[model samples]
Target: MTRPGFSAVSVLGVCLLFTLSGCSGTPAPAPTTGSASATATATATASPSPTAPTSQAVTPSPTATAPPSSAPPSSAPAGPTETATPTAEPTFTGFPEQTGPLTIYYVAIGDNGVSGPMIGCGDSIVATTTAPVRFTDQVGPSLGTLLVNKSRDVGLSGLVNVLYQSNLTYVGGELVGSTINIYLSGQFMLGGVCDIPRAKAQLEYTAMAASGATSAQVFVDGRPIDEVLSLK
Candidate 1:
Protein backbone atom coordinates (compact mmCIF):
# COMPACT_ATOMS: atom_id res chain seq x y z
CA MET A 1 0.00 0.00 0.00
CA THR A 2 1.13 3.59 -0.79
CA ARG A 3 1.06 6.33 1.72
CA PRO A 4 -1.42 9.01 1.26
CA GLY A 5 1.24 11.84 0.74
CA PHE A 6 4.62 10.66 -0.50
CA SER A 7 6.10 7.38 -1.70
CA ALA A 8 8.97 5.89 0.25
CA VAL A 9 11.53 6.51 -2.45
CA SER A 10 10.46 10.09 -2.80
CA VAL A 11 10.69 10.54 1.00
CA LEU A 12 14.20 9.07 1.05
CA GLY A 13 15.24 11.27 -1.83
CA VAL A 14 13.99 14.37 0.05
CA CYS A 15 15.95 13.29 3.16
CA LEU A 16 19.07 12.87 1.09
CA LEU A 17 18.67 16.37 -0.41
CA PHE A 18 18.40 17.94 3.05
CA THR A 19 21.47 16.07 4.31
CA LEU A 20 23.57 17.27 1.36
CA SER A 21 22.45 20.84 1.84
CA GLY A 22 23.43 20.63 5.51
CA CYS A 23 26.88 19.22 4.74
CA SER A 24 27.68 22.07 2.39
CA GLY A 25 29.16 25.38 3.74
CA THR A 26 26.68 27.42 5.69
CA PRO A 27 24.60 29.33 3.23
CA ALA A 28 24.83 33.13 3.13
CA PRO A 29 21.83 34.71 4.75
CA ALA A 30 19.49 36.37 2.35
CA PRO A 31 20.11 40.07 1.89
CA THR A 32 18.17 41.74 4.63
CA THR A 33 15.39 43.79 3.12
CA GLY A 34 13.40 44.97 6.25
CA SER A 35 14.06 44.96 10.01
CA ALA A 36 17.58 43.29 9.64
CA SER A 37 18.73 46.05 7.25
CA ALA A 38 17.61 48.64 9.83
CA THR A 39 19.54 46.82 12.59
CA ALA A 40 22.83 46.88 10.51
CA THR A 41 22.40 50.63 9.75
CA ALA A 42 22.05 51.38 13.53
CA THR A 43 25.31 49.45 14.29
CA ALA A 44 27.25 51.37 11.60
CA THR A 45 25.95 54.75 13.00
CA ALA A 46 26.96 53.87 16.62
CA SER A 47 30.66 53.17 15.64
CA PRO A 48 33.25 56.08 16.01
CA SER A 49 34.80 57.58 12.75
CA PRO A 50 38.44 56.74 11.79
CA THR A 51 39.95 59.97 13.19
CA ALA A 52 42.07 61.39 10.24
CA PRO A 53 45.51 60.53 11.74
CA THR A 54 44.38 62.63 14.80
CA SER A 55 46.62 65.63 13.86
CA GLN A 56 47.21 67.53 17.22
CA ALA A 57 46.85 71.36 16.76
CA VAL A 58 50.20 72.92 17.77
CA THR A 59 49.82 76.35 19.58
CA PRO A 60 52.85 78.60 18.89
CA SER A 61 54.47 80.69 21.78
CA PRO A 62 54.12 84.52 21.78
CA THR A 63 57.18 86.66 20.64
CA ALA A 64 59.09 88.78 23.24
CA THR A 65 59.43 92.64 22.97
CA ALA A 66 61.44 95.37 24.81
CA PRO A 67 59.70 97.96 27.01
CA PRO A 68 59.58 101.65 25.86
CA SER A 69 62.08 104.20 27.36
CA SER A 70 60.81 107.13 29.55
CA ALA A 71 63.25 109.81 28.29
CA PRO A 72 62.15 112.46 25.71
CA PRO A 73 63.92 112.86 22.33
CA SER A 74 66.21 115.92 21.80
CA SER A 75 65.27 118.45 19.04
CA ALA A 76 68.61 120.34 18.87
CA PRO A 77 71.21 119.52 16.19
CA ALA A 78 74.26 117.58 17.43
CA GLY A 79 77.61 119.57 17.53
CA PRO A 80 80.56 120.40 19.77
CA THR A 81 79.95 122.70 22.81
CA GLU A 82 81.84 126.01 23.22
CA THR A 83 84.34 126.55 26.06
CA ALA A 84 85.35 129.82 27.84
CA THR A 85 88.70 131.52 27.09
CA PRO A 86 91.14 132.47 29.86
CA THR A 87 92.32 136.06 30.46
CA ALA A 88 96.01 137.08 30.16
CA GLU A 89 98.01 138.68 33.00
CA PRO A 90 99.59 142.15 32.84
CA THR A 91 103.41 142.75 32.48
CA PHE A 92 105.53 144.38 35.21
CA THR A 93 107.93 147.36 34.84
CA GLY A 94 110.64 149.00 37.05
CA PHE A 95 110.86 152.20 39.11
CA PRO A 96 110.94 155.69 37.61
CA GLU A 97 114.15 157.72 37.11
CA GLN A 98 114.88 160.82 39.26
CA THR A 99 117.23 163.26 37.52
CA GLY A 100 116.90 166.94 36.64
CA PRO A 101 118.02 170.45 37.58
CA LEU A 102 117.30 171.27 41.25
CA THR A 103 115.23 174.23 42.60
CA ILE A 104 116.34 176.52 45.48
CA TYR A 105 114.24 178.93 47.56
CA TYR A 106 115.49 182.39 48.52
CA VAL A 107 114.06 185.43 50.33
CA ALA A 108 112.06 188.17 48.54
CA ILE A 109 110.08 191.10 49.84
CA GLY A 110 106.28 190.74 49.90
CA ASP A 111 103.79 192.94 47.99
CA ASN A 112 103.94 195.15 51.14
CA GLY A 113 107.41 196.26 50.06
CA VAL A 114 110.72 196.40 52.03
CA SER A 115 109.05 198.41 54.86
CA GLY A 116 107.18 195.18 55.75
CA PRO A 117 108.52 192.83 58.42
CA MET A 118 111.04 190.25 57.14
CA ILE A 119 108.67 187.71 58.54
CA GLY A 120 106.23 188.72 55.75
CA CYS A 121 108.85 188.19 53.06
CA GLY A 122 108.02 185.90 50.13
CA ASP A 123 110.15 183.21 48.51
CA SER A 124 112.14 183.54 45.26
CA ILE A 125 113.13 180.54 43.16
CA VAL A 126 116.68 179.99 41.94
CA ALA A 127 118.15 177.24 39.76
CA THR A 128 121.53 175.57 40.39
CA THR A 129 123.37 172.52 38.92
CA THR A 130 124.96 169.54 40.67
CA ALA A 131 125.69 165.98 39.53
CA PRO A 132 124.04 163.93 42.26
CA VAL A 133 122.41 160.50 42.17
CA ARG A 134 120.21 161.08 45.23
CA PHE A 135 118.14 164.07 46.39
CA THR A 136 120.15 164.28 49.66
CA ASP A 137 123.35 164.96 47.77
CA GLN A 138 121.70 167.71 45.74
CA VAL A 139 120.44 169.52 48.85
CA GLY A 140 123.86 170.58 50.21
CA PRO A 141 125.04 172.28 47.06
CA SER A 142 121.67 173.95 46.54
CA LEU A 143 121.78 175.37 50.05
CA GLY A 144 125.36 176.57 49.55
CA THR A 145 124.20 178.57 46.56
CA LEU A 146 121.46 180.11 48.69
CA LEU A 147 123.75 181.34 51.51
CA VAL A 148 124.88 184.38 49.49
CA ASN A 149 123.72 187.70 51.00
CA LYS A 150 122.67 189.51 47.84
CA SER A 151 120.08 188.17 45.39
CA ARG A 152 121.90 189.98 42.53
CA ASP A 153 124.77 187.53 43.01
CA VAL A 154 122.38 184.81 41.75
CA GLY A 155 121.34 186.98 38.74
CA LEU A 156 118.28 188.41 40.49
CA SER A 157 117.36 191.96 41.55
CA GLY A 158 114.93 193.50 44.08
CA LEU A 159 115.29 190.43 46.38
CA VAL A 160 117.18 190.86 49.73
CA ASN A 161 118.86 188.27 51.93
CA VAL A 162 118.73 188.89 55.72
CA LEU A 163 121.74 186.60 55.99
CA TYR A 164 123.85 189.26 54.20
CA GLN A 165 126.67 189.21 56.76
CA SER A 166 125.41 186.10 58.64
CA ASN A 167 128.50 184.12 57.55
CA LEU A 168 126.29 181.02 57.60
CA THR A 169 128.02 178.02 55.99
CA TYR A 170 126.45 174.88 54.60
CA VAL A 171 128.07 171.92 56.36
CA GLY A 172 126.01 169.05 55.04
CA GLY A 173 122.48 167.84 54.26
CA GLU A 174 121.03 164.37 54.70
CA LEU A 175 117.67 162.69 54.11
CA VAL A 176 116.68 159.86 56.46
CA GLY A 177 113.51 158.28 55.13
CA SER A 178 111.20 161.17 54.23
CA THR A 179 112.78 163.69 56.65
CA ILE A 180 115.49 166.19 55.62
CA ASN A 181 118.33 167.19 58.05
CA ILE A 182 120.61 170.15 57.38
CA TYR A 183 123.85 171.07 59.25
CA LEU A 184 125.47 174.48 59.33
CA SER A 185 128.24 176.35 61.22
CA GLY A 186 127.52 180.08 61.32
CA GLN A 187 126.84 183.19 63.33
CA PHE A 188 123.19 184.13 62.69
CA MET A 189 123.02 187.90 62.82
CA LEU A 190 119.62 189.60 62.53
CA GLY A 191 119.70 193.34 61.88
CA GLY A 192 116.14 193.74 63.06
CA VAL A 193 113.36 191.83 64.80
CA CYS A 194 111.93 190.85 61.37
CA ASP A 195 115.29 189.35 60.35
CA ILE A 196 114.59 186.26 62.50
CA PRO A 197 111.76 184.94 60.33
CA ARG A 198 113.57 185.98 57.14
CA ALA A 199 116.55 183.75 57.99
CA LYS A 200 114.34 180.81 58.92
CA ALA A 201 112.31 181.02 55.70
CA GLN A 202 115.39 181.17 53.48
CA LEU A 203 117.16 178.17 55.00
CA GLU A 204 114.06 175.95 55.45
CA TYR A 205 112.53 176.71 52.00
CA THR A 206 115.84 176.09 50.19
CA ALA A 207 116.49 172.81 52.01
CA MET A 208 112.94 171.50 51.43
CA ALA A 209 112.89 172.40 47.73
CA ALA A 210 116.29 170.82 47.09
CA SER A 211 115.55 167.61 48.99
CA GLY A 212 112.04 167.31 47.53
CA ALA A 213 110.77 166.95 51.09
CA THR A 214 107.97 168.81 52.84
CA SER A 215 109.92 169.59 56.06
CA ALA A 216 113.56 170.20 57.10
CA GLN A 217 115.43 170.69 60.43
CA VAL A 218 118.44 173.05 60.48
CA PHE A 219 121.37 172.67 62.98
CA VAL A 220 123.81 175.48 63.67
CA ASP A 221 127.05 174.70 65.58
CA GLY A 222 125.42 171.41 66.77
CA ARG A 223 122.50 173.46 68.16
CA PRO A 224 118.94 173.25 66.84
CA ILE A 225 118.18 175.91 64.21
CA ASP A 226 115.13 177.01 66.21
CA GLU A 227 117.31 177.78 69.25
CA VAL A 228 119.93 179.63 67.23
CA LEU A 229 117.39 181.65 65.25
CA SER A 230 115.46 182.52 68.42
CA LEU A 231 118.55 184.03 70.10
CA LYS A 232 118.55 186.72 67.42
Candidate 2:
Protein backbone atom coordinates (compact mmCIF):
# COMPACT_ATOMS: atom_id res chain seq x y z
CA MET A 1 0.00 0.00 0.00
CA THR A 2 3.01 2.17 -0.05
CA ARG A 3 2.97 4.14 -3.46
CA PRO A 4 5.97 6.40 -3.30
CA GLY A 5 5.72 9.63 -5.22
CA PHE A 6 1.97 9.80 -6.07
CA SER A 7 -0.02 11.79 -3.60
CA ALA A 8 -3.86 11.81 -3.29
CA VAL A 9 -4.36 15.55 -3.76
CA SER A 10 -2.71 15.70 -7.29
CA VAL A 11 -4.82 12.90 -8.63
CA LEU A 12 -8.06 14.47 -7.50
CA GLY A 13 -7.28 17.86 -9.26
CA VAL A 14 -6.41 16.26 -12.65
CA CYS A 15 -9.67 14.36 -12.74
CA LEU A 16 -11.81 17.55 -12.05
CA LEU A 17 -10.18 19.39 -15.03
CA PHE A 18 -11.04 16.61 -17.49
CA THR A 19 -14.73 16.64 -16.40
CA LEU A 20 -15.05 20.46 -17.04
CA SER A 21 -13.56 20.27 -20.66
CA GLY A 22 -16.09 17.62 -21.82
CA CYS A 23 -19.07 19.69 -20.64
CA SER A 24 -17.99 22.85 -22.74
CA GLY A 25 -18.07 21.11 -26.34
CA THR A 26 -21.11 22.02 -28.83
CA PRO A 27 -23.74 19.34 -30.01
CA ALA A 28 -24.35 18.35 -33.89
CA PRO A 29 -27.57 19.68 -35.85
CA ALA A 30 -30.39 17.24 -36.95
CA PRO A 31 -30.91 16.38 -40.82
CA THR A 32 -33.78 17.96 -42.95
CA THR A 33 -36.59 15.67 -44.54
CA GLY A 34 -38.28 15.87 -48.17
CA SER A 35 -41.80 15.80 -46.65
CA ALA A 36 -41.23 19.05 -44.78
CA SER A 37 -40.09 20.91 -48.04
CA ALA A 38 -43.14 19.62 -50.06
CA THR A 39 -45.55 20.82 -47.32
CA ALA A 40 -44.22 24.48 -47.56
CA THR A 41 -44.49 24.61 -51.48
CA ALA A 42 -48.14 23.39 -51.43
CA THR A 43 -49.15 26.01 -48.86
CA ALA A 44 -47.85 28.89 -51.18
CA THR A 45 -49.63 27.42 -54.33
CA ALA A 46 -53.07 27.06 -52.68
CA SER A 47 -53.29 30.69 -51.51
CA PRO A 48 -55.06 33.15 -54.07
CA SER A 49 -53.59 36.59 -55.05
CA PRO A 50 -55.64 39.81 -54.57
CA THR A 51 -58.13 40.38 -57.57
CA ALA A 52 -58.31 43.80 -59.51
CA PRO A 53 -61.57 45.83 -59.54
CA THR A 54 -64.06 44.98 -62.48
CA SER A 55 -64.99 47.88 -64.93
CA GLN A 56 -68.64 48.07 -66.29
CA ALA A 57 -69.22 49.20 -69.99
CA VAL A 58 -71.58 52.13 -70.49
CA THR A 59 -73.90 52.36 -73.71
CA PRO A 60 -75.05 55.79 -75.05
CA SER A 61 -78.62 56.52 -76.32
CA PRO A 62 -79.47 58.41 -79.64
CA THR A 63 -80.53 62.10 -79.35
CA ALA A 64 -82.40 62.97 -82.60
CA THR A 65 -84.93 61.17 -84.93
CA ALA A 66 -86.21 62.01 -88.51
CA PRO A 67 -89.92 62.83 -89.24
CA PRO A 68 -92.13 61.04 -91.89
CA SER A 69 -93.39 62.81 -95.11
CA SER A 70 -96.96 61.65 -95.83
CA ALA A 71 -98.18 64.89 -97.41
CA PRO A 72 -96.89 68.10 -99.16
CA PRO A 73 -95.10 70.87 -97.25
CA SER A 74 -97.16 73.61 -95.54
CA SER A 75 -95.40 76.57 -97.36
CA ALA A 76 -96.81 75.77 -100.87
CA PRO A 77 -100.45 76.24 -101.99
CA ALA A 78 -102.64 73.88 -104.12
CA GLY A 79 -103.46 74.62 -107.82
CA PRO A 80 -106.89 75.81 -109.03
CA THR A 81 -109.30 73.51 -110.94
CA GLU A 82 -109.97 74.11 -114.71
CA THR A 83 -113.45 75.04 -115.95
CA ALA A 84 -114.91 75.19 -119.54
CA THR A 85 -116.80 78.14 -121.00
CA PRO A 86 -120.22 77.86 -122.73
CA THR A 87 -120.82 78.86 -126.38
CA ALA A 88 -123.47 81.41 -127.39
CA GLU A 89 -126.33 80.74 -129.87
CA PRO A 90 -126.82 82.77 -133.06
CA THR A 91 -129.71 85.28 -133.45
CA PHE A 92 -131.44 86.46 -136.66
CA THR A 93 -131.15 90.26 -136.84
CA GLY A 94 -131.37 92.03 -140.27
CA PHE A 95 -133.01 89.50 -142.59
CA PRO A 96 -135.87 90.91 -144.74
CA GLU A 97 -139.39 89.53 -144.51
CA GLN A 98 -140.36 87.13 -147.35
CA THR A 99 -143.68 88.50 -148.51
CA GLY A 100 -145.67 88.30 -151.78
CA PRO A 101 -145.84 85.24 -154.09
CA LEU A 102 -144.29 85.66 -157.55
CA THR A 103 -140.60 85.30 -158.47
CA ILE A 104 -139.45 86.67 -161.86
CA TYR A 105 -136.01 86.88 -163.44
CA TYR A 106 -134.48 90.21 -164.55
CA VAL A 107 -131.08 91.14 -165.97
CA ALA A 108 -128.31 92.80 -163.94
CA ILE A 109 -124.56 93.39 -164.42
CA GLY A 110 -122.20 91.17 -162.46
CA ASP A 111 -118.43 91.35 -161.90
CA ASN A 112 -116.16 91.95 -164.92
CA GLY A 113 -118.80 92.78 -167.59
CA VAL A 114 -120.90 89.66 -166.82
CA SER A 115 -124.72 89.74 -166.78
CA GLY A 116 -127.35 87.33 -165.45
CA PRO A 117 -130.94 87.08 -164.17
CA MET A 118 -131.90 88.08 -160.60
CA ILE A 119 -135.05 87.14 -158.69
CA GLY A 120 -137.88 89.67 -158.09
CA CYS A 121 -140.49 88.64 -155.51
CA GLY A 122 -143.77 90.55 -155.77
CA ASP A 123 -147.57 89.93 -155.57
CA SER A 124 -148.38 90.73 -159.23
CA ILE A 125 -145.05 90.25 -161.11
CA VAL A 126 -145.47 86.62 -162.24
CA ALA A 127 -148.05 83.79 -162.00
CA THR A 128 -147.82 80.87 -159.53
CA THR A 129 -149.99 77.91 -158.39
CA THR A 130 -150.32 79.17 -154.79
CA ALA A 131 -150.64 82.87 -155.84
CA PRO A 132 -151.61 84.33 -159.29
CA VAL A 133 -150.08 87.81 -159.85
CA ARG A 134 -151.66 89.88 -162.65
CA PHE A 135 -149.00 91.50 -164.95
CA THR A 136 -151.04 94.75 -164.98
CA ASP A 137 -150.57 95.24 -161.22
CA GLN A 138 -146.78 94.69 -161.58
CA VAL A 139 -145.67 98.35 -161.49
CA GLY A 140 -143.20 100.74 -159.79
CA PRO A 141 -139.54 100.19 -158.67
CA SER A 142 -138.98 96.66 -157.40
CA LEU A 143 -136.35 93.91 -157.19
CA GLY A 144 -135.18 92.62 -160.65
CA THR A 145 -137.52 95.15 -162.36
CA LEU A 146 -136.10 98.54 -161.28
CA LEU A 147 -134.07 98.13 -158.12
CA VAL A 148 -132.20 95.04 -156.80
CA ASN A 149 -133.87 94.43 -153.40
CA LYS A 150 -133.09 90.88 -152.21
CA SER A 151 -129.43 90.82 -153.28
CA ARG A 152 -128.39 88.14 -150.77
CA ASP A 153 -130.85 85.65 -152.29
CA VAL A 154 -128.92 85.77 -155.57
CA GLY A 155 -125.39 85.46 -154.07
CA LEU A 156 -125.01 89.24 -153.80
CA SER A 157 -124.93 91.40 -150.71
CA GLY A 158 -126.64 94.82 -150.19
CA LEU A 159 -128.77 96.67 -152.78
CA VAL A 160 -127.41 96.48 -156.36
CA ASN A 161 -128.97 98.77 -158.97
CA VAL A 162 -127.89 98.19 -162.56
CA LEU A 163 -129.78 101.21 -163.93
CA TYR A 164 -128.34 103.77 -161.50
CA GLN A 165 -128.69 107.46 -162.52
CA SER A 166 -129.43 110.89 -161.02
CA ASN A 167 -132.51 111.58 -163.16
CA LEU A 168 -133.46 108.42 -164.98
CA THR A 169 -136.94 107.32 -165.92
CA TYR A 170 -138.28 103.84 -166.70
CA VAL A 171 -141.26 104.58 -169.00
CA GLY A 172 -143.00 101.24 -168.41
CA GLY A 173 -143.65 98.40 -170.93
CA GLU A 174 -146.26 97.58 -173.61
CA LEU A 175 -147.18 94.28 -175.33
CA VAL A 176 -147.87 94.84 -179.09
CA GLY A 177 -149.10 91.48 -180.43
CA SER A 178 -146.08 89.08 -180.40
CA THR A 179 -143.53 91.92 -179.91
CA ILE A 180 -142.85 93.55 -176.45
CA ASN A 181 -141.61 97.16 -176.14
CA ILE A 182 -139.83 98.57 -173.07
CA TYR A 183 -139.11 102.32 -172.95
CA LEU A 184 -136.43 104.34 -171.15
CA SER A 185 -135.94 108.18 -170.81
CA GLY A 186 -132.54 109.17 -169.53
CA GLN A 187 -129.05 110.19 -170.56
CA PHE A 188 -127.74 107.11 -168.69
CA MET A 189 -128.35 104.70 -171.52
CA LEU A 190 -126.68 101.30 -171.49
CA GLY A 191 -123.48 101.69 -173.69
CA GLY A 192 -125.03 103.80 -176.52
CA VAL A 193 -127.27 100.79 -177.55
CA CYS A 194 -124.62 99.37 -179.96
CA ASP A 195 -121.07 100.05 -178.77
CA ILE A 196 -121.57 97.65 -175.87
CA PRO A 197 -122.73 94.13 -176.72
CA ARG A 198 -123.19 93.28 -173.03
CA ALA A 199 -125.54 96.26 -172.58
CA LYS A 200 -127.56 95.25 -175.66
CA ALA A 201 -127.92 91.71 -174.39
CA GLN A 202 -128.98 93.01 -170.96
CA LEU A 203 -131.75 95.24 -172.41
CA GLU A 204 -133.08 92.49 -174.66
CA TYR A 205 -133.13 89.96 -171.80
CA THR A 206 -134.82 92.41 -169.40
CA ALA A 207 -137.46 93.32 -171.93
CA MET A 208 -138.33 89.67 -172.60
CA ALA A 209 -138.53 88.90 -168.88
CA ALA A 210 -140.81 91.88 -168.16
CA SER A 211 -143.45 91.24 -170.86
CA GLY A 212 -143.04 87.47 -171.43
CA ALA A 213 -142.78 87.98 -175.17
CA THR A 214 -140.85 86.08 -177.88
CA SER A 215 -139.10 89.24 -179.26
CA ALA A 216 -137.86 91.97 -176.89
CA GLN A 217 -137.71 95.58 -178.23
CA VAL A 218 -136.12 98.60 -176.52
CA PHE A 219 -137.05 102.28 -177.18
CA VAL A 220 -134.98 105.09 -175.73
CA ASP A 221 -136.20 108.75 -175.84
CA GLY A 222 -139.24 107.83 -178.02
CA ARG A 223 -136.95 106.31 -180.71
CA PRO A 224 -136.37 102.62 -181.46
CA ILE A 225 -132.92 101.50 -180.13
CA ASP A 226 -132.25 99.41 -183.25
CA GLU A 227 -133.05 102.35 -185.55
CA VAL A 228 -131.05 104.83 -183.42
CA LEU A 229 -127.96 102.62 -183.18
CA SER A 230 -128.23 101.16 -186.74
CA LEU A 231 -128.18 97.57 -185.43
CA LYS A 232 -129.06 94.67 -187.83
lDDT of 2 by residue, 1-232 (tens): 9678867898988888898878876756654677667876787678866788679776788868847665566677545545779778888573343434443333333333233333322111111112444343342222234333323233343223334331345676777897777777664433343224433444555455544577867777898765655646
What lDDT score belongs to each candidate, Candidate 1 first? Answer: 0.68, 0.49
Clashing residue pairs in candidate 1, if any? none
Q: List ranges where model 1 is wrong by over 4 Å.
A: 1-100, 112-136, 148-156
lDDT of 1: 0.68
Candidate 1 global TM-score: 0.45
**Considering every candidate listed, which one attains the maximal TM-score?**
1
Each prediction's TM-score versus the true structure? 0.45, 0.33
- Mark the 10 consecutive residues where model 1 has the least summed lDDT: 121-130
